[model samples]
Target: MRRRKLSPEERDLWSRVAATTQAIHPVRPAPPDDLPAPQSTPKQKPPPPKPDLRDFRIGQSAPGFVLRQDLAPPLSERLAAGPVRMDRKAHQKMTRGRLEPEGRIDLHGMTLAQAHPELIRFILNAQSAGKRLVLVITGKGKRGLDEGPIPQRQGALRHQVPHWLHLPPLAAAVLQVTPAHQKHGGSGAYYVYMRRNR
Candidate 1:
């Protein structure tokens, strides 16, 4: 306990009382070369390179994969954008196959629980047998084994038989579903048109 060395007039009176007090730990002044040097919030663009899947395997085939857009819009362009409901000159001769399906119903190999009760018993017996233009084939769909990650729109009865001919037990015996002309089965058949059994 022997410390005592300050005599130069007490080291100029302790450097004038430590430059008039104040420095609980302050030595940080070195940033004046014309300001502006603290901007670090622009590094968030490194998240778009995750499609390598380590030499990817599951059913390969993505070499130049280019789909550019299609999360739905080809069930024959959603049944040719609906809204024709029937009889515009017999729906233009049943979509140009020149009207002639007085009842067809193939539904391919069934299985949406046997094609929704055989398409609600063939559109309620083709509108109680008064048919007007049946057809309803549903084929174009076999590309299977996609292995998930969403992308399966091939033909579960060509998109659920035009959504079970518009639900409610065949939307009251249909009356106009369209999409069938390429000689009656283009986007895989579907010219329902029935309602008329009063």
Candidate 2:
């Protein structure tokens, strides 16, 4: 059926009537005060005043809240800055010679020139292969039997290895450099703990 267009006055009146029309609440008989609540699902308790601790998801029946990772401190600041000491358990185990190294590199005969580069390469390779604990054997130098014209120092690599590990290139990968446990070579070697590769 064709509809007729309304005059301006009729349109204004109709708009006013529509604007005045309020949504009406549906009416239903209330349940008796003693009637049990619906059993299809349990009522949810209101969430605690504070948000839950972790970001874990809850069961389908319940809702979960995501903790704000964006509001957290930046990674550089959050991390313990320079070098992370081995966690207590690992430190204890390592100090006691219980935790064995995943890999080891011996600089028994390499010169200072050779040892530095080799040390860097060894650490990088270990980190790439996902080895966290490793041994770096820098053998203790032999003592001179006779007093030479020039006095020589013993354990050059032993002293230098610690310094090299602290340098920038290897420093980022190396977590800690410590004296090797007795079973690993004692004073002649070092235990290098590497950070997880990102």
Q: Count the backbone clashes (under 3 Å) in each candidate.
A: 0, 0
Model 2 per-residue lDDT tens digits across residues 33-145:
89976668778999769966756565634344323223544322333244547797887688678988999999988889999989888899999999999999998877544
Local accuracy of candidate 1 as per-residue lDDT tens digits, 1-198: 999987999899889988999989989888899997787897777777766556778998766533344566677776777788765887887788887888788878777888789888878987897877788787887866655667766667788878878889788878778788887768887888888888
| Pairs clashing within candidate 1 | none
User: Best-fitting candidate, measured by TM-score?
Assistant: 2
Residue 100 of model 1 has an lDDT of 84
Measured against the true structure, the TM-scores of the candidates, in listed sequence, are 0.26, 0.54
Candidate 2 whole-model C-alpha lDDT, 0 to 1: 0.79
> What's every prediction's RMSD, in angstroms?
16.7, 22.1
What lDDT score belongs to each candidate, Candidate 1 first?
0.79, 0.79
Worst 10 residues of 1 by lDDT: 64-73
